[model samples]
Target: MDVNGRVWLIEANPKPGRTLFIKTGERKVYRTSVRRPLQYAMF
Candidate 1:
């Protein structure tokens, strides 16, 4: 559980979105990006 200097990116299931998880010592951070309706329109 010593997740220091570690960075990772992951995708959330059951929906269209992206997530990122980062950890450093006792601190942890997360970032998530959900595909916007307009953004998906191009696809």
Candidate 2:
């Protein structure tokens, strides 16, 4: 899901997809790849 978990929580489906019995807003970001990183954005 995106940064806002509140959104896209449910879709318009009468059959019902995967039921979300529980949801925790706890999230953590981490980098698992090693590469040259630049701290600047090219415009």
Candidate 3:
């Protein structure tokens, strides 16, 4: 964000860390994160 409070996305990761959610006990999110792309590709 800048002084005017406007947010900007500078970069993105295609393959992000997958274990963080599991370490934080967010199993559902971890599963969805792993599954959604496969589902989309299948369709």
Off by over 4 Å in 3: 1-15
Alpha-carbon runs more than 4 Å astray in model 1:
1-35
Clashes of 2: 0
Stretches > 4 Å off in candidate 2? 4-6, 16-43
**Which model, 1 or 3, shows the larger lDDT?**
3
Question: What is each predicted model's overall lDDT from 0 to 1?
Answer: 0.38, 0.29, 0.86
Output the better candidate (1/2) by TM-score. Answer: 1
Q: What is candidate 2's lDDT per residue for 1-43, written digit by digit as tens?
A: 5676553545445343122222232222112111112222121
RMSD value for candidate 2: 14.7
Best by lDDT: 3
- By lDDT, the better pick of 2 and 3 is 3
Q: How far is candidate 1 from the true structure (C-alpha RMSD, Å)?
A: 16.4
Give the Å shift of residue 16 in candidate 3.
Answer: 2.8
- Give the Å error, residue 8, model 3: 28
Residue 35 CA error for candidate 2 (Å)? 47
CA shift at 20, candidate 3, in angstroms? 0.8
